[model samples]
Target: MSEKIIFAGTPDFAAEHLKALIEAKYNIIAVYTQPDRPSGRGHKLTPSPVKSLALEHNIPVFTPVNFKEEADKAQFESLQADLAVVVAYGLILPERILNAPRLGCINVHGSLLPQWRGAAPIQRALLSGQDKTGVTIMQIVKELDAGDMLYKKEIEITTQDTSGTLFERLASCGAQALVEAMPKILAQELVPQKQDSALVTYAQKLSKDESPLNFNHSAKQLSLQVRGLNPWPVATTTFDEVVYKVFLAQELSAEQVALLGKIDDLENGAIVQVSSEGITVKCAEGCLLLQTIQAPGKGRVSAGDFARSKKDLFVRGKCFA
Candidate 1:
């Protein structure tokens, strides 16, 4: 017999796993997602991605603020689900809810265990320039993401990957990983391994303050920052007293670095050169070629195009603070 599952999650990441489970013919008795919140410019109440998917599948949905209320716990207990699958679920499940399922709750976390064990793992991995990251299937505990691992699958972190791209990839990866692990889980053939507490590193949530590009960092670091922040709180820098958002950037080549070295008194964050390829800027360690950028109230365009239209503003020696 197939295991009965109670699904809990909120965002697109969570919805992807639910879709995978549904496609695999898992018995999802009900779904628990965060309450609908005001979204977009109009501030209209919007359902979470998981809720929308659950509704489409005609699965029962619950949006409890928390399980602190005895009624909420009672309602969950009444389901008597054999298992619970959680992915990017916003709310913390109390111990009662965690133990309610016969097989307990398992989480599809977007990072390798013992590292990036908190929220925003995808963005954190990109910002840290990790060569790779992956999904971890683990038994959920009371502590935040401090779970016993059942399975993990790694994927390379390409230089060109932005947080938005990585997010999509990991979401799909997590779905596949969960689907593969579920059979072993149901058959009682999988053993949960304890994570080393010494290797734990938390991924603090992203903040608006981290959006500004700091030229003091190396070009490689700045490039990673720009990529990691894309699609949300995008990296920005002030050039000629105007804030411009950076979308795509790359570290300069050895030839370009030598060319920049020839320029006397080159200061970090100063415009180095502008060509058909892109706009190059000096950095603390090397140089960065800005491929894509967006000025306030303007659509994103190639740095070369921006330079062509605003040549005076991008002249060599102007610094981006």
Candidate 2:
């Protein structure tokens, strides 16, 4: 527990782990996070959540663009840290930097090892409709999240989970898992298990291009898309040439299955019904209920509220492009 530690991360997820280590009273010698970037309406440079948290603790913070520079690499080595803990650090570390620490580095990844190993694991897991996913504490190999596993804590992927919600849960899960693994790692009691290459699956970064909702897909698939993209590049639909962001969505209930059968021949994406509850849009195989939506330059509102404000647009037989 006296080992000098270097904490590296960027987002709120990483901040959570940093907070855990601090609360556990670990010797966090320094912190590493991405450089401040322009954010929000004014585009002012904003510190990452990790940086802010570290600063609050009066911890020395490093924001090197990368270890590509000799000075940056040397600065890291000068610390002579026993271990480096990385989580959602954004920057890909070089092998030299990874080896700078005496005990090398370990990553708290947001996925079960050998699968969903990339930048957007939580979102990809939901998008793929996985029944369960988990966090993995692994060695920091040169390859992208292709490290040997140290420990894993699996959790169920509930039907109600969105990437945003999963982010919060996984951050907490990963934080506890990391803190639990640290002592064993320092004591050399933990064994590393090699990953199964055959079972590997990557979760590529989410894209704005992937945000558009396509009614051509089944309602179930569309529902996944909506959940996966929530809180970032939200699932969108074109209505009257305006882009409307979709938040909450659902497939028809067992009783409502009869309703879809009635309009089994109607054009997909056409409005089936608009009630006080939501706007039902027919899909390729079934109907999807749009529960919440957001218009350009406006706050998110329930689908029923949007319908009331734009009654003409939600009229039956009208199509959403």
lDDT tens digits, residues 123-208, model 2?
A: 99999999898899999989888888999998999889999999999999999998888899998799899999999999999999
The most accurate candidate by TM-score is 1
Residue pairs of candidate 2 with colliding backbone atoms = none
Provide the global lDDT of candidate 2 against the true structure.
Answer: 0.92
TM-score of 1: 0.97
Q: Quote model 2's TM-score.
A: 0.96
Off by over 4 Å in 1: 259-261
Candidate 1 lDDT, 156-197, residue by residue in tens: 999889999999999999999999999999787898899999
Q: 54 in model 2: Cα distance from truth in Å?
A: 1.0
